[model samples]
Target: MTSLSTVLKESWGLVEDRQDRVAQHFYARLFLSDPQLRDLFPVQMDVQRGRLLGAIVSAVQNFDSPEDIDGYLRSLGRDHRKFHVTPEHYSQVKVALIDAIRAHAGERWNAVYEQAWNDVYDHIAAQMIAGAAEDTEPPYRHAEVIHHERRGADIAVFTCRPLQPLKFRAGQYVSLECHYQPRLWRTYSIANAPREDGTLEFHVRAAGGGWVSSALVRRLKAGDMLRIAAPMGSMTLDPQSRRDIVFVTGGTGLAPVKALLDELTRYNRTRFIHLFRGERQDDDFYDRRHLDEIAESCPWLTIVRAVSDEQGYPGERGAIPDVVSRHGPWRDHDFYVAGSGAMVNATLRRLTEMRIPSTRIKYDAFTDA
Candidate 1:
């Protein structure tokens, strides 16, 4: 019997040999056959090809151990959710990939090569389908930037067009693509829920090192055309469920949670919402007044602001997990943690220790750093 390890190793070697060629063929076929997918790709084919090939290489190499395979596949499934990749797309890519492999391997390629590649593609496609089933199409008809308010320092609030039409459930995010840098993109959650018109909004903090973000801060203006990917995330209000919702965030991570709160208020669902927001200081915080207004309007919504660098705040004074342990109702509430990787990982660990099931926790790490 050919073990998974053996097959995976051979697959990796085969892929490494022809990864670039496979990527080229894949893009050529996709663009030639499906103009829509071609439009989805950045104009710079080489850069996009490199990214796709690198991702495939990483995916195959990570499967060297069976233990690493499942997690790696699942992560791809989740990532593909945002891409809106379907079974058809997977099939197209698979055919192109296998053909490229055969071309590169020539006489050396045999039944073993066919079987291994088939197995890998099948596993990836199934997981992607599973992820797609859980996501819903975005409700907003059109998105446009109407108002841009500069908050203290690097923070700003962009009130968008379509006004307040449909409510964006808290914890859901919208992918933003800039015209100048089409390949560079970022996702920001709505800071407020639907009000009257169909307008959506976002709270963005300028990351100096981020190409797209810095461009948004410096060059983007009202009436600028911005492409937005559909909203897809697991973190949102569960109306039928009555579990407490703990929202822990840092920086602009507050956007999605605020959207969630808007939905909760609209439906008059009174689930306890604990919002733990961390920033460098009070000045670094955005939407304090709006959050306070929401707290005032909804008695069940408890907003806790944590300034990590400031000493004077009476509420939880340090990291989110510390505040969570001190004042959280973890036993009864589902948790939605967002922000930097370190903060999310720390909060996840604390939640696990607090005996909250992993299934009850949802998170979106905005930045890998």
Candidate 2:
């Protein structure tokens, strides 16, 4: 008998390249079946469209690793509470997803494949439902932008005060919705540890064709109201581990890493922390002064800044992975990495080559999609 993973992979391969078409078909069928569900998503559906495909692909790729993928799916499910998703919504999604895949697979689609998908999706939905039911926190919270500062041409630093205390670890991220963008939501890491005043900080860099990111960077300002969902992520520091730490980050990925470092400063006495921040150019290093101050006070902290694509640079130069590899023999240190998918993957690859155990490396790929 053919295994479910083999059948799912075979069927998915047929339609993976046509993801956009499949997504369009799925959403059309979904809304047609239940128009009320349309209001759950943003008016601009470009980014939202691809998310469905991405989720399915992730599940398919990790089908064999039930233990590992279950945690991620549950996390995804818990996070979906922000969208007001309920058990009924899962049924709708399952039907729409199966329909989309079947349509895209065409001649290759079979009852066997359909059943396999049903079983897998049912499991996914159940895990998600269980995750949602287990959480007692509110789906989302209202916040007021207390401060906003433009860092560069396309980046901004902002702070928001939640109407209620928004509890979260230093390295977690929360989905945010702005008044200007309505239902459109974007995920941003909190840039500080939990504070007495319940204020949260964020660093945003506008990307081309990014609706929410562009709005946050270019239009958001003080007094603006925003909605923030509960935090989600596991790249936080391990309190039990006494291992020294190395944080590798680039761009606005510095947010969560900075937060982790801030928390570390409060009680960290023995762990020597090395922070390697990379930017395309020197001017792009927006939070230099703040990081420098943190390093000054925290004698255990060392900050290294590297620049790529610039000439006559006074400091470290080259890609982040290359510069980071030079400072190691970091096999003994726990690694926390964040940045673009490319940067994260490259760093992971380099660390693996250095014989760093996979168990000691934690990374979060910062994507607004």
Candidate 3:
């Protein structure tokens, strides 16, 4: 008897190489079946396709672990409410997904594989529905951008005051939709910890051609209102235990780390904290002044600046993995890593090599959002 995990893993390997085709075909089939569903998604399907495939693959990879499966599915389900995903859409998605796989997998996809995939999809959909049912608040809230700051060349810091109190943990991220781009939502880590007022902050890095990120950083101005979805992500620091904290942040990935640090400061817990912020050059350290101020205020905080790829940089220059290892034996510390997929994966690999317990590490990833 084959386990569900083995079935899903094996089938994933068959389709991993041609994921691009799988995503494209899946959307084509989905849109063809119901033209109305197409409006829910962004006009530009290229990026969304990859993200969809990646999300599905990630789900399958973690399905074997009961906790991973439950947590991820619940988050996905709850977050989908903001996208206005309905019960019927999940059914449509499963049909499109299975059809895409069947067409692409060809001879390799057997009845057993089909059954296993179907069962998994059924579980995913069920959990998603349960999650959606549990949420009662409005799908999203309105936030006015009261403050905007351009740091470095392309980093935009926006301070938004929500119409109502948007309760969220320090390290959680929020999906924001700019007026300029309707229905085109992007995920940005809330850069500040919970404040007394009804306000939240985000640090956005404008990539060369990223539509939302580019527009927010370059074109967005104060007084513009943006639609905000419920807060998502599980990056909160453990409040009960006063564990030493270690953070590895790449670029604007520092946002969540900053929030976590603020959380620590709020509690005034005398725990040791180390933050290694990596950038390309000294100028890339947009929050240097702020970080320095934080270190001054918090005696237990230590900041390590790592600059890579630039010559004669006036800071400790090396990749994140190298600079982190130089800091030496970081035993018995809760590690928080926020960065691109490559940065997080590489940092995790390096930390594991140092014999740190994998369970103790917490990750906050910044991707297209």
TM-scores of the models, in the given order?
0.71, 0.97, 0.95
Kindly list the per-residue Cα lDDT of model 1 for residues 1-369, writing each as its tens digit.
877657756755755666777778767776666777775566766545666656655565455554546544554565455455667887777776677666676666788868877877677667666655554644223456777777756767777665234434566777677776775556677666656666777777777656567666666678866666555566776657777788888877887787777778776655777888887677777778888998998888888887777788665578778778887457877888888777889888988888988878888887511
Off by over 4 Å in 1: 1-40, 43-114, 122-142, 162-168, 311-315
User: Which sections of candidate 3 miss by over 4 Å?
Assistant: none
lDDT (10s digit) by residue, model 2, range 1-369:
877788888888889889889899999989999999999988878768887667776786568867777887787788899888989988998898889989988897889888988988888889989989898988899999999999999999999999988889999999999977888888899999998989999999998878889999999999999999989999898989999999999999999998998899889999999999988899999989989998999999999999998998999999999999999679799999999888999999999899999999999887766
- For each candidate, the alpha-carbon lDDT, in order, equals 0.69, 0.90, 0.85
Winner of 2 and 3 under TM-score:
2
Clashing pairs in 3: none
Q: What is the lDDT of candidate 1?
A: 0.69
On a 0 to 1 TM-score scale, where does candidate 3 land against the true structure?
A: 0.95
